[model samples]
Target: MRTVGLALVLASLMAGNAMAQPKWAIVVHGGAGVIARAHLTPEQEAAYRAAMTRVIQAGGEVLAGGGSALDAIETAIGLLEDDPLFNSGRGAVFTAEGRNELDASIMDGATLKAGAVAGVTRTRHPISLARAVMEKSPHVMLMGAGADTFSHETGLEQVEPAYFYTERRWRSLEQFLTQNNLPIPARPEGAAAPDAAAGLAHDEGKYGTVGVVALDQAGHVAAGTSTGGTTGKRWGRVGDSPIIGAGNYASDASCAVSATGTGEYFIRLTVAREVCALVEHRGLSLQAAADEVIQQKLTALGGDGGVIAVAPDGQMAWSYNTSGMYRARLADGEPLSVGIYKDEP
Candidate 1:
């Protein structure tokens, strides 16, 4: 009888501890591409690592402080959008016409609410505009000049079209256009003369979009994706980053997903929603779902890139087919981790 009583007490204590533990997890990705070690100088590699570390630490603080998953993901993605190293807001890649157009999407798992903006030219932070559309408007997406106009009416910070330029990205645009045998437009009016950013491989690790997926203490999941579209893309082209279910998806019933890669392929496969569908309908683990979609399905389609996900049960996973993907993660009570190469654990 004493043994049984002791077992019961211990069981109760275990349950109490479990209830007290907070469950929050977050994952971030800068981009995915043919990033080989030999291509980058040591200084270039260090820059990416330090930037990813800083972004994850900021996200961790939000989740640890009991902030919503939506807030955490938006905060993280916004920072990535601002960083010139990744291809989002500042230093975004240029279109064939020598202009930068941004796209972004955000979703709330608990409510299945989502918002997106495409071809937005003036907004400083496209992720925030996406969230504002979700909470403040009745629509799911806005596009082009209309989106920029809406941003102005909504009182979001706007920037001169020239603010997105960087010499590195400009060089990338010129290279892509030259290699493709396409007409290369003269550098935009605001761009300074190019410098020696040419030694680094332009298409190495920064080929896709920036994304964040998070599961908060409230058991809600959220995701956001932002990008400047592809280098040397058509003047009005839009990518998967701003399209929910294509590049971004969230649902409490399954998981939140943010994808980066060939936009047309992601859109055709509905990659983001497919991950959640596999989790909800096939009982797959978060990692397994991400692998199935990114590895098997996307690979069969001859596509490149990857995805990051967070489940309601605190699982966080990332999968990519490229040689390297700039990524980081942090969970409550767990140490933060950041990685770049496929060889990394």
Candidate 2:
């Protein structure tokens, strides 16, 4: 009888310890750039906060219910992509040709498997297509019409190009054109100036990408990123969002990262991979690695943007050099939180 009682006590203690440990965590970002709190009206701030809350809750529920990190991250980014407030999916910025060209990528940390799509025009959810590429196709990346065709072959929903149109985005594109003294008419084939297309100003903090990083109950890490590329981008330009290791990276040994900001800079720096490398090679903590990469390295390179990262142990961290980043986080036993300005808590 005493032996049986001792066994019961040990079992109970083990159960308690498991219950006390955090099961999962998720972090997401809309975009990152020169966002200032004073520039936003109170109503606008409230709306952004509400949207962040909704996204975190939706994704958090999946993590809490024992969903894979891949599912949670994809679910979170898909919500941001569908919302017109962010620079992805329905709200993607217009290219130099006055059209939307989207890019997206997804990564699984356990297996280091990744998939990406670039310059896809009609996919309703580019992130889903990214996953499809990862799972259904053998390729790690697909682009332009090829990606759209693969998306169709995989049975992902397709939307008309008109579905991406938004008055706000059109206005932003017009403003960019006016600032550069470029006419509203489309440039002739092979005549577009690379500088005119590449250097156009972006909306505040809307360098126009959305991303998510999640740690699941099973201890797997996953990340995803989606964007409409740059405003006034030409010649089928693809951004870091669709480039694994630049915009998205994950590793069960280190962390999962999703980035938003200037695609060119991110690509040059390989921002996501740098963070993971720091953690794996230098033994830096996830927070320290993320900060070094986002605040120090990227800043030194004149890159402005940020990243959301989650570690296998449920630690979460985000860092940006820009004035603000649209970000949110949820973890076991913690309150859901969202922020848009540099000074926000």
Candidate 3:
């Protein structure tokens, strides 16, 4: 009788240990817009896919190693900010005045603390600055020259405005101004002449922003977003990227969300928070909640954009209204998956 009782106790303990195992996952997006398969050459698609693959692996390593969701998301988003393929830091699109003005935000789900920066021109990685704002400053957001000054004081990397120049984005800026019949701003100081080989891929209304939502082994979730705002924006135009609850939100009780799309529409709808609200308030699954806000609500409002999300349970999802969205996801002990077009499974 004594032996039987001891065996039962051991069995119960083993079951509890198994249930306590952590589940981690991460999802990312480069942008969403009118990216039709017919428009992207095979080479272009491959380039984008390779970039997303690299980002997912780098971020996934952090979660797999038991890092906090906040660290994992910051690592992932900082890489995207460095990569020119997406519009966050380097290779960012230019304003109407031909200057690069960047925006970024980060949210920690475990504590609900958030940080953001807007119109930062000299900071090399705006995402890091955003995190600094959350960790170092008393404010939720800092913008324009004050944000730049804070960045300088924080000792974040700074660069000459010319460092952001790239032939691809410059050509897009030129083409955009030409089509809209706006006066062309002179080439920025220290920027090189535009290359004739640069491709023409300009769509200010549709594509451009980089974001990440990560759920770590500790069951914490976090979200981040970064962008150069819309092309040819004038008079200090800021976008949803740096706006908490608009382009980025995170909550361990529900989910973490990062969005990319037209700034005005996202701001109008509070897209990121809306997705999380559906899950917390309406008892929707991660996928269903994302679809409900992006596919139905945003679409009905005539907005075009997309969102990537991860819940504390490690459920991951992405939804978009555009023809394509540059996205990728990875779950604990699962293969990395990437999707670009609307038709992908």
Candidate 4:
């Protein structure tokens, strides 16, 4: 009788510990573009990988501490936005007019609520502003000066347009102008030219966005995405990043998805929602749905890029049609995985 009681007590303790352990997962992507190992120097590759790892770990800490999925994803994307290495906020690409424009979106799976901002030039963290729109305003989307004004009203951080000025991004604009044979616009008298070597690789010029999808301990999922839009974009172009169904989608019944790539194709296909539909309606697994949407549907339309998706069951999937994607993942009881090239573990 005594032995049996001791065994039962031990079993109960084990169960308690298991239940207390965190059971969430997170996946993030810097961007998906024509990233070939041969084209990237060793230093550039290492830098990208390090940045991704840092972002994922930062997000993981939130989940481990019992934060909501929405909080984790927003925190992760905020870091990326602050880093000048990725093309979301601080590192945003230059428009045809030599200015930086940014966009971002965030969605809550539990409530099916979302917020987005587009074509904003001065808001520092667009992802946070997107969340503010979802939580504070009655509107689902805001644009241009309106979004900036809301950001101010909401007391979110704001910066001058020049605060986004990075020499690397400036050089990218120069390269684009040179390649297109467009006349290089003269800089203001006191403005400085960017270092010639500061620009990203030529092929990486397009498709630079950052996103995250996460599943928390309570089984809620959330997704968020941010972007500087495509390089040399003109006429106030907004990419899929700020579009809810295209670049970001979340649902407790299925999965949360955040995408990067050609905004037009994503918008036309509603890529993120399409992936969720395949899971909700067709009963497809998260991996199957993401693969089909990224590899087949988007490819058929001449679109390229990838997505990070997390299911309600703590399963995560990342799929891309490009040669490489800057991605990282962290799941309960699994080793952290970060990769920039296709063949990496």
Candidate 5:
């Protein structure tokens, strides 16, 4: 009898240990948009797929090998930001006035603490500044010049305005302005606007790009998003990126969400938080809630785009109304991806 009891106890302990084994996961996006078959060349599609593959692999390896969730999120986003194809860090889009204004936010779901920076120029890593704000500052968000000041106080590297200039972004801006027939602004001082023949400003109505979500690791969750603010935006437009539970929201009790698409519709719906709340309070599955919000609510509100989410039980979902979204997910140890564009898929 004594031997049997000891054996039973040992079996229970081993089972517990097996269940307690740590698991790691991550999801990412390039940018969501009306990605039509006609728009992508074979080369561009291949490039996006390759880029997403590299970044997701980098982040997944870190998580699979016992990395922190924070590290995973930052590492994944950093890669996307560096890629000019996405609209975040280095490859961010151009504003109406033809300048780069970036916004980013990060949240730890376990602690419910967050940091964000808006309209930051000259900061090498806006997400790092956001982390600094969450960890070091009294505020949840800092914007414009104040954000710059905070970056300086924290010893973050600052760059000249020219550092962000790239032919692609300039060309995109010019194409957008020309397509919309918006009045062209006088060149800054002696500078001349890029030639109109370059298809500049062709896609101006399509500008909002952000990403966020949580991972399935035990007792951990996080949400983050980054973007180049709306193109041709006037009056210092600030979107939901820096707003808690708007552009990004996370909770260990429910899920984490990152939104992309039209910023106004996201703000109108309180899109990120609403999804989490529906799951937490209304008992909706992560997929159902996301569908309702992205498909139903935002659509009814006259907005288009999508969101990425992860529930506590490791359930993952991507919901969108656009032609394509730049997204990838690792679930149950399988690499799954969803995208409209050929390269990102």
Candidate 6:
């Protein structure tokens, strides 16, 4: 009888301790797509690793210094947005019409508060605008010229169209248009041709990337996403990056997710929310949920790429079906770190 009573007491004590333990972490992704081995040269790989390290360090510092999860997530994602290689901010791909249209979103898990901006031009930082819309306005999302107006009204820097122009993006647009028959009108009607018809081949050489989900010392969760819209996209196409449950989503009582891959398919799957659902509904582990959605479901559905996820308990997972993904993480004891390409992990 005494033994049974002692066992019950110990079990209750263990549960209480587990509940009291601090749980916090951050995971991030560069955009994801058809990442192939041949595409990454050694020098490029090294550069990616170095960039990941810097951002991870910056975000981890915020968390370690007792900053809010929002601050940490914003800090980390900003670094990736600045890197030209990832196709989010400066390196954003060109539209079919040879212009830059960017999208971004951020979610605060604690309050289930969220904000997003889509198809914005001239706004220097899409994420900043998204954050502003979340706190300053009653709206959850804004698009196109309207988004730019809000940014200007709120005192966010507005760049001219020239600020977003990049030769690389221009070339990418030209290549896509050329394949569709150069000198053709800027608009291509209907859907893009299949892989064979339009010569729509996946160029593994240029993979897209986004960044950061952080759980800070106070156990709050935050997630953010930013992306240059797709390369050679027509019809003013907007992607999942600006969609809350597709590219990014978070909840204080559950988890946070940052998604990468073919934006269209991700939107179809509602990939970010699916991760949280797996945990809350199915009671699966965080890593298990990520693998199921990013690796199994997304892959089975013919979507390529990956995601970064963090449970409220601070369990972190990064999973992808591509040849590689740009990712890095920081835990309780580890110092700042970085990872580029696929091979480093």
Q: Pick the candidate with the highest TM-score.
A: 1
lDDT of 5 at 193: 34
Candidate 2, pairs of clashing residues: none
Residue 290 shift from truth in candidate 3, angstroms: 0.7
Alpha-carbon deviation at 302 in model 5, angstroms: 0.6
Each model's TM-score? 0.93, 0.89, 0.91, 0.90, 0.85, 0.87
> lDDT at 5 for candidate 3?
100
Cα lDDT tens digits for candidate 5, 1-345: 999999999999999866654365567776677776677666666666677778877777767767666777777777766666666666566777877788999988888899999999878778778888999988899999999999998998787654555556666677778888866654334224333213211232356564645464554878888887666566678887777787888888888888888887788889999999999999999999999999999999898878888776677788888877767777535655645553443
Better of 2 and 4 by lDDT: 4
Tens digits of per-residue lDDT for model 6, 1-345: 999999999999999978654555677677666555576666666666677778887888888888988888878877776666677776677776766788999999999889999888778778888899999999999999999999999998787765665555566777777888855334223213221101212244434758588888888888899988787777878778889999899987678998877888889999999998998889999899999998789988998878898877888888888777778888666444455456666
**What C-alpha lDDT do the candidate models reach, one value each?**
0.88, 0.86, 0.88, 0.88, 0.74, 0.77
Candidate 2: which stretches are off by over 4 Å?
A: 1-20, 186-202
**Where does model 5 exceed 4 Å of error?**
1-22, 179-205, 336-338, 341-345
Candidate 2: clashing residue pairs, number: 0
- Model 6, residue 136: distance off in Å is 0.7
- The positional error of residue 89 in candidate 2, measured at the CA in angstroms, is 0.2
Clashing pairs in 3: none
Q: Poorest 10 consecutive residues of model 6 by lDDT? A: 193-202
Candidate 1: stretches off by over 4 Å? 1-22, 193-202
Q: What is the lDDT of candidate 3?
A: 0.88
How far residue 280's Cα lies from its native spot in candidate 2, in Å, is 1.1
How would you encode candidate 4's per-residue C-alpha lDDT over 1-345 as one tens digit per residue? Answer: 999999999999999877654399999999998888898988788778888899999999999889999999889999999888888887788888887889999999999999999988879999999999999999999999999999999999998887677777776788888899876665423336353235443346477899999988888999999999987888899889999999999999999999999899999999999999999999999999999999999999999888989988777899999988899999877789998888875
Poorest 10 consecutive residues of model 5 by lDDT? 195-204
